[model samples]
Target: MKRSLPYLLLVVPYLLLPAVVQGQSKVRIACVGNSITFGHGLPNRTQNSYPGQLQKLLGDRYEVMNFGVSSKTVIRSVDNAYTTTSAYREALASKPDLVFIKLGTNDSRLPYRLKIDEFIPDYRQLIQSFKSLPTHPRIVLLLPVASFLTDTTRQTEQAISSLIIPRIRQVAFEEKCALIDLHALTIDHPDYFPDKLHPDSLGASVIARRLHEAVTSEEVKGFDFFAAIPQPASISSFYGYDCADFTLAGRACKVVKPRFAANGLPWIWRARFWGHEPQTDIALLDRGFHLVYCDVAELFGNAQAVAAWNTFYRFATKAGLAPKVALEGLSRGGVYSYNWAAENPEKVACIYADAPVLDLKSWPGGKGKGKGSPADWVIFKNDYGLISEEQALAFAGNPMDKVAEIVKGGYPMLHVVGDADDVVPVDENTAPFEQKVKALGGQIQVIHKPGIGHHPHSLPNPAPIVDFILKATKP
Candidate 1:
């Protein structure tokens, strides 16, 4: 038998060559792109490129290689006619189980012929080169990450990704390869990317996880055609109505009106503070920061909430309060406080939600009710033209979502909730939020009083919440 084995050895290479030559990634992946995929700005090679992160997500099950080149152009290779003529040969050399191509960022700036005309044929040739290999790996063309603003350059890039990348996908589909649309995963997630263009390690991790799930999961839907569109500004700006008074019409508000008019757009004011047991006299009188309160529709006094909030802003301005402000509210007032604070984070110095109802989606009675009161779901639908309960819920954005946004931008929050309060449960209110702030590498002060119930102002000492503000807001 030993003597016979020597004769078989000669033919073994020929048999094994087919398997080796055919790209069956027992478990390997190849990531190829520009600096965006290469983890530019990351201090170490072992740090957070999407490829490095993808390998970690796959554990030992898959091997991922990074073949990204900074300032490299796919057009340079394609117009010249080979996928890897000495130029990108280094990237082509790392044969992989799966290949991810993230191109077209730099390609958008080149001559139109290079991006639209030459790119497809060049990409087709590249695909052919890979298919010619004994081990033909699966290929995935990741759409280029979206840019910050839709300027001329970014518009060009977006157009390239929107138009040319589809051709790449068609080639992948014809070849039976995988396709991952990172453009969708990152559509509304701006905080993930540090600069508008490149993914921070955190952003890279998000892309990697999305990619991993796309490859491994049975139900990986490509980017949604109708996902939520961000408002194109910070949630904080919405809360503050930031410069709405000035920017929209390009002039300062000259006089206070019964109905707020911005650029002559008829608008009503709603204040969330006022009608508290002890009264927010101290807050109303503060000359340091202007406070914009959003009054509940009517419970805290219908249009009166808006009236009171405006009065305060007017009074504060009269009293020499700084343009930057802070918000404070209790129980129902919490809704107004959170909303206003979130909308105007830059102007909002801080926020104090004293036993406030943060989420209307899941609130008292696990339902909403009351006229002019924001708690009612049916009313929201009727009032806001919302078609469904989910739409209604989404209609009113969640300020809690912006807590990290606020903290990251240096606006602190102080929350005081009763642990035993059923009206606004601790677990549902500020407790979970406490964890979020900690996770985001931000700081928020939350004071939990054990055995306490519903009303935060009813606490024996409301002074602590006040004290936190004084300390936080002080120059």
Candidate 2:
């Protein structure tokens, strides 16, 4: 392979192996590619590389080998012909039963991309090398991981999209090799490739899981990841991704999927306000968190609401969502988040409240300095079995009342409030709660919008909110 890139890294040999498990004849799987495949810039590369993760996912049934070199291109005449590397030779000598060839990232760069004319032929030749093996290995072509370099250098995304991917698809068709479109799998998740060219450990796990499904013959006739859930009532587009609306225990539930599920399939369960100011939900979807919602509205996050959420939680976790989940509370949704967290503290990953109504007395109850919803107020009273205004006013069962218990759950909290919001004033709702959490030495962050109101629930740039959730749910 040509070594023209200035920062070409040494191939980590431990993640993938040159040998199989002792005393067992496991299927020999060889992962062949460049630095991305070699686990460049990833911590504990030997254990977190795509191949390493694949080895663990496949368990003792297969021996995965990582024969990856940095800056290696499939084009033999290029500055770094992947075929010229020791990894290439060793990969061939390993006599693999299965091969995943993920080349072309390096070839997408400026000077190297000049040799684009040779990609198809060279890639075809590379495929033949493994096809000629005695084991007659099944070859799988991996399109390069998508990059967000935003420039012409460092494996240009435009080059990969325009020059490389089509060629890989063509060669896969001609060679009859399996194709696992890594580019499509990862394009929406630029965050996975922190450096824009190489994926971190979490991103590597996405590739590994996709490969696992292929090897294990796991087939999903219409849907894949959400197949474990009950059949959806319908599937439609929600913010450019698949939205499965299904009935779970007689309640309508929605799950807007990411382009690909992130590692562990972490998710954010929205309590209410399905799509209002949905910037944060959309962003989390791109980062591989499923945006879910269960309609338990009108119940005002009462015991019934919490019970419904408990049922949804059990079903969702059973269907493969992480046991602990991030909770999204928009306005009245705060009640659902806090009430549920109070009931099932161990299940909450974190809480994000936007212009939330932490205290019923402030909003629907109208017992303080904030505009109250008369119609919802009646509904709220009846929902909580409040005999009259007296009962509703004195009800200390609201989210604000449960701050101590919620903080004791050990999940951090994030609040986005509009300082001028009269619909749900921060002073009566979130402010006192924040003060209490701080007084109790609990974790809580508040982002106040100076003049903004409650209409817009999230920030224009949801990065800070997303970052907070990501940090809390880091696996």
Error of 2 at 74 (Å): 27
- Counted clashes in each candidate structure: 24, 7
- Candidate 1: Cα lDDT at 111: 51
Task: Put down candidate 1 lDDT per residue, 142-243, tens digits, no spaces.
Answer: 766666655554434466556655665555444544445555456556776676677788879877876775556321112111112112322222111121
Runs in model 1 lying further than 4 Å from the true structure: 1-26, 77-87, 112-115, 149-151, 154-157, 218-475
lDDT of each: 0.52, 0.80
Error of 2 at 112 (Å): 31
- Runs with alpha carbons beyond 4 Å of true place in candidate 2: 1-224
Q: RMSD in angstroms, candidate 2?
A: 12.1
Best by lDDT: 2
Which stretch of 10 consecutive residues in model 2 shows the poorest summed lDDT?
1-10
What TM-score would you give candidate 1 relative to the actual structure? 0.39
- Estimate the overall C-alpha local distance difference test score of candidate 2: 0.80
